[model samples]
Target: DTAVSQTPKYLVTQMGNDKSIKCEQNLGHDTMYWYKQDSKKFLKIMFSYNNKELIINETVPNRFSPKSPDKAHLNLHINSLELGDSAVYFCASSRHRAAGVNEKLFFGSGTQLSVL
Candidate 1:
């Protein structure tokens, strides 16, 4: 019984390759998000989707795109992967759409993406 799942927990690849990280939630949540944590452990919200509609797009590079086929899943697709993009990509979810501000995020173990 996985509450949230993200594939390729460790991704190592050469630069300029296109890669995608998949995510899924079985917690019956209405909102899902993607977060990136750098080597310094500073986490930043990348994108968020509610009911398959994008609600937040942070100051991320155009190479990064998020897709949600349904409310339970949100996947991250990265084109022209670069060294700067190497970070721990986390998939998170909340019970309510507006509950993020107050509620703690339920995060996946994370996809440690490494661009060589």
Candidate 2:
């Protein structure tokens, strides 16, 4: 089984439509994250949640939201999906939030979102 998994590997939608990408991990991790990769391949951490609290990256827009009901899942919801929102979203999880060289982010295959 994959450590991290996301649904709808490909998403195609028109402008103004709302869509959600779901993520789940079975790695026994405490920290889960959502990242967005734009057309330029610039990857940015959009949200990071550790158990009960959420930490949003300052640069991320308000349209993006991350919800975690428990430690093993993190779901991403994009509001008013726009063309600029088109990108590959990645779900990842790590053992903990502590900064350690050995700490690794186990990522899902990724979801490709295209807004027309």
Candidate 3:
């Protein structure tokens, strides 16, 4: 079984459209994250949830939100998407250790979003 999985592997939509990517991990990890990779290949963390509670809220636009129904799932919702939002969105999960440290993350195959 796959450790992490996401739906809609490729998405193409026009500006101002709303979209969401669903993610789930079977690894039973406690922490999940949403990461975005811009065209230039810079990866930035948008949100982090640990045990179904918001932990790290990065400086992402308000239009983007991370929704987690449970510790095993974290979904990314984008409202009024814009051209600059076109990028690869990744879902990752890891076991957080003591002293605020975490283990290696197991990432899902990214979802490519193209805003026209």
Candidate 4:
């Protein structure tokens, strides 16, 4: 009964490697967001997609790119993974078009990425 789902709950990779995390939502939301939680448990927005269009892109590294195939899916691909990139990546969605800021977002259980 998960509204949002992400693959590979645990990811272990080497430094300078590349990896991808896939996300999907079934709530028919208009906006999807990617967030990263660092070691200190601080969460920061990385990217956002509204109806498969890029809307908000924070000052993330160029090696990190987000691709949304449709309104239901958002994928994050990271290249040249660094030690600082080790964190928990979360996928969340909200009905930005309908509820504005009042809508609560649904977030997937994050993918824990560890760089060796």
Assess the local accuracy of residue 65 in candidate 3 as a C-alpha lDDT between 0 and 100: 85
Worst 10 residues of 4 by lDDT: 95-104
Better of 2 and 3 by TM-score: 2
What would the per-residue lDDT of candidate 3 be over residues 1-116, giving only the tens digit for each residue?
99999988999999999999999999988999999999999999889999999988989899998899999999999999999999999999998723255469889999999999
Candidate 1, residues 23-59: lDDT per residue as tens digits?
9999998999999999999999999999999999999
Q: What digit string (tens of lDDT, one per residue) describes model 2 on residues 1-116?
A: 88999998999999888889999999999999998898999988888999847965657777887889898999988889889999999999999988499799999999999999
**Candidates ranked by TM-score:** 1, 4, 2, 3
Alpha-carbon shift of residue 89 in model 3 (angstroms): 0.5
TM-score of each: 0.95, 0.95, 0.94, 0.95
Model 4 per-residue lDDT at 44: 97
The candidate with the higher TM-score, 1 or 4, is: 1
All predictions: root-mean-square deviation over Cα?
Answer: 1.4, 1.1, 1.6, 1.3
Q: Give the TM-score (vs. native) of candidate 4.
A: 0.95
**lDDT of each candidate versus the true structure:** 0.95, 0.90, 0.91, 0.95
Residue pairs with clashing backbones, model 3? none
* Lowest summed lDDT window (length 10), candidate 2: 52-61
Off by over 4 Å in 3: 97-102
